[model samples]
Target chain A: MILKSAEAKPHIVVIGAGAIGSFYGAILKRAGCAVSVVLRSDYETVKASGFRFTSPLGDLSWTPDHVYQPGETPLQTPDYVLLCVKVLPGVDRAELVRSWLGNHTALVLIENGLDIERELADAFPDNPLLSCLAFIAVSRTGPGTVNHQAYGQLVMGNFPKGFDQHCEQLANLFREGGIDVNGTDAVVGERWRKCVWNTSFNPLSVLANGADTLTMLDAPGGEALIRLMMKEVIAVAEADGYPMPPDIIEKNISGTRAMGAYKNSMALDYLNDRPIELEAIVGNIVAIADRLDVPVPHLRTVLVTLRIRQGVDSAHSE
Target chain B: MILKSAEAKPHIVVIGAGAIGSFYGAILKRAGCAVSVVLRSDYETVKASGFRFTSPLGDLSWTPDHVYQPGETPLQTPDYVLLCVKVLPGVDRAELVRSWLGNHTALVLIENGLDIERELADAFPDNPLLSCLAFIAVSRTGPGTVNHQAYGQLVMGNFPKGFDQHCEQLANLFREGGIDVNGTDAVVGERWRKCVWNTSFNPLSVLANGADTLTMLDAPGGEALIRLMMKEVIAVAEADGYPMPPDIIEKNISGTRAMGAYKNSMALDYLNDRPIELEAIVGNIVAIADRLDVPVPHLRTVLVTLRIRQGVDSAHSE
Candidate 1:
């Protein structure tokens, strides 16, 4: 059902108030969608003084029309719940968001990492499930403040079918909000393409111990390593029948190089003494490669050290 | 040809009085050989108080017969010049001890890493380079003080031919000092065997940013990575016609596991801001593998990052 105007505007409940969640939710709200973001520690501060969005284009300040925790919101069932929480290990994501998941509420995961949809899909199969790959350069510099540094493109697709009417409607909502959304049936391919950069550089940035991207690229064999790792990712993706572009390696490298002196999310978390999203990022690649009998030696070697750094001795274990 | 009496005792000059040099030189002095150690910053304190040897068996303190700077040492041509300095990039190993090299002076290298003797042998062909792989656990905890930890075994073998009377004589000299030194006809084999541990754990320890052995091993996939890297080393060694034992993997693992908790030399140097030995330890293995057309991907992967950490983009160059 293509809802239009006033009553037709779908309400989106942003599940996590981090950078992506806040920025996107604010954008959606500004674009006439009923956007409600769950405010945690900054509930009072953000609720009272509102929040700030510092982007290249301009700055915006607005109080959210609806602000409440899960189950505290006045709406019985939000049209959609956009999850932006980090898919790290030991997070009982299903349980944490149980209160917000109404019977028919569609769940859109605007998160990073691979193979993340299975659990939630299994738990709430009836509700529509969408996997979103965020290609935005955004950061939560301070409490309730999001700094949109660079890109803000989001690629999404509905589960199993990859694309459906719901996916189109959601993509339309995002496009109207000025998000530059891309709807694709090849969600897996899109993810693998993004992983080309994430797998190559995220943990490496962590290993660099908060060294920015430029400094990391400055390391001898470092830039070449990025290309090699990206090529490796491409190989695995091709093996899994989700082939990406021939020049994907160059494209990813140039893209990251253009990011210019940015510290990746993994490095930022590492520097702040918080756990990075290990399972969703590198571990899934290793797992999938093992399942396919593909030799991913470079990924294995780097992942082993990365796991050790994260104090995780074993990966993909229950 | 082993001399027994003091009148026929061979004079030895020990260069680089760090842990390995100080401990071994002191042991030679204790065994009645005329030993003169070239001192650096530790010169004055060691010269004033002599030196203290704190071994597991017992502690011994003694003043040296002669201690001086490298160029100021009295002996023009000592029987042996023990080189224990790190073979890192930019260090002129030959030129550092050019003044000590005499026509008949046998140069003994009690150091870590692989293929280290090739250059020195090329530089001074007639010096009879004796490569001693120190399996002993000893460290210079402070100036003029050495701590003898777990193992105290030295494997000495003559280069090129490996087995010679000089090797056996050096073994005997160490034996008289209560050191358990073994002479082998397989110097390359011994170095490769030690490289099993060094290549696997050394760079990793550095990458861990000075995390000690146990801490490193305790990390997830840490032990498995050690085995994998060791297997890769063995493959390269076997291809190069230096076939190590089939059970070398198990032996190396058990032996390192038995070391309990100790930081490898690379980690120690990294923590102290001193340059870690990259060329000799990892770079040599990589070079030999490349020469032999053997793929040692794991070692290559680790070495690339390790080189960056050591501030070396490349090795063995001006």
Candidate 2:
């Protein structure tokens, strides 16, 4: 479904005002869009001082045109609703943004993992559902504070395929705000590319008990295990009709090696006793593999370990 | 070399008097053998009050005929030296028992893991070396106390091949002491059989953060992961010419399920921050698989996770 562009200065609503949501919303606002933010944990702080972002794309302080606490409706209809929450289990994402979604408001999910757009697409049949992948190193350091370590390019497309007029307009707005954006027709394939790295490093970091990228790669038999897991992912992808480039595994390994001692976010989540996106990141791939009858023993083993740990962790908390 | 039976009462010396050593030494003494134990940490307490055993075989308290500290030589040359220490990476097992071995003494290793007899075989070229596997559930509750939960069967054979008269002599001694004994010529195959269980549960328990058998088996994808790892072990064993029985994996799973909530030894070692037997158990299997050109991606993946965790854990302690 190709979506048409809205008026010149469109109103943008940010559903989750965390790192990715806050960063991209501020970028759109810099292009003269009227931005409103919805926040819970950092509502008071953001309402008081707004957000301070430190990024290579140019540091800036962004105060939303309007701020609304969760469960409160915005006064103006939004042109776009950016969903940037972590894709964790037990969160009904479609219901989270139902109140703010207007008739023409295109839902853009600038998040991780695959098949994340299905629920929202099912909920709002007429709305343009844009699935996005944010290739950026950003984290929320403190209340209303964001730190962008590296890269800030976004790849986005319509629900299942094709770039539309609205996607082009959004890209132009991001370019005007000094951030690079790519409108791709094959954004789902791009997700598989990203998963080549995510599936190997994310759970491995936690399993290593909070090891960094290099620590995982440098340990005995670490590189081989990572390669085996990456091959499993590739097999699943290929069997699902998205064969990756021959050099993708090598590129991911060398790329992670260059990142030095960066701890993947899932490891940080596990260390901080927070819920992780185990289901979205690795579980879906294994599920697909099971359907395809493509054996993915390596990924399945790691997935089970993460599941047990997550289960036991939540059980203890309860 | 075949070993003839000793005089009416054989002189047996036990080294590394932890759980296995203590239990077996007490049993030998019950059969009227003159047993002497070498102690380290529990020397004073054991010398003062001896050991107390609680087992289905029978409950009894027995003091050793002689108790010598480490580095002290017993007055009489032992007919058999029992080595029951943990097969960790460091603390050379051969060197630890070097001072206790004599010209006529046979070294019996009642330990867990594979390829564990090679070092002792090299160290004592002329002396008899018997490799034995203890299928028992026992733990040292206190300095000089042991709690045996179930099963006290010993599988023994001469190292690297055929059983000799000493195997028969030792089996008779164990039988007289009210313990079950199986003296097989195919002990290496038996080691592989034991590994079908150890390679899966031991490392997996630690990976689950000290979870017991039921917790591991009950979690989603847990049993499948265990089965995958067990299959890999079987593959390696078959490639190396010791194919397991068809029902080995099922037998192991059901046996563990009936054990209630049992934490494996490696998991307990991890919980207590002691060194694990990762090398002797899973590492050697992977090494053999590598040499045999048999792919064991599941075992290799789990092996690297355990290695990194063990390495990171030791580093943090240092």
Q: Encode model 1's per-residue lDDT on A67-157: one tens digit a residue.
A: 7865474464687888889898788778656678778788889989878888888888898888888887788778777788877888989
**Model 1 residue B181 CA deviation in Å:** 0.8
Q: Please give each candidate's TM-score.
A: 0.92, 0.93
TM-score of chain B of each: 0.91, 0.94
CAPRI-wise, candidate 1 is acceptable
Residue-wise C-alpha lDDT for candidate 2, range A1-318, written one tens digit per residue: 112232457889998989889999888878878889999899999999999999877866799978898799989989989999989778999988999998898888988887677788899999988888988888889999999887779998887888998898888988888788988898888888889889988988888888888878889999888998899989998998889999999899888777778888888888888778888899999999999999988898899988877666666689
| Chain B TM, cand. 1 | 0.91
C-alpha lDDT values of all predictions: 0.78, 0.87
Q: In lDDT terms, how accurate is model 1?
A: 0.78
DockQ (C-alpha based) per candidate is 0.41, 0.65
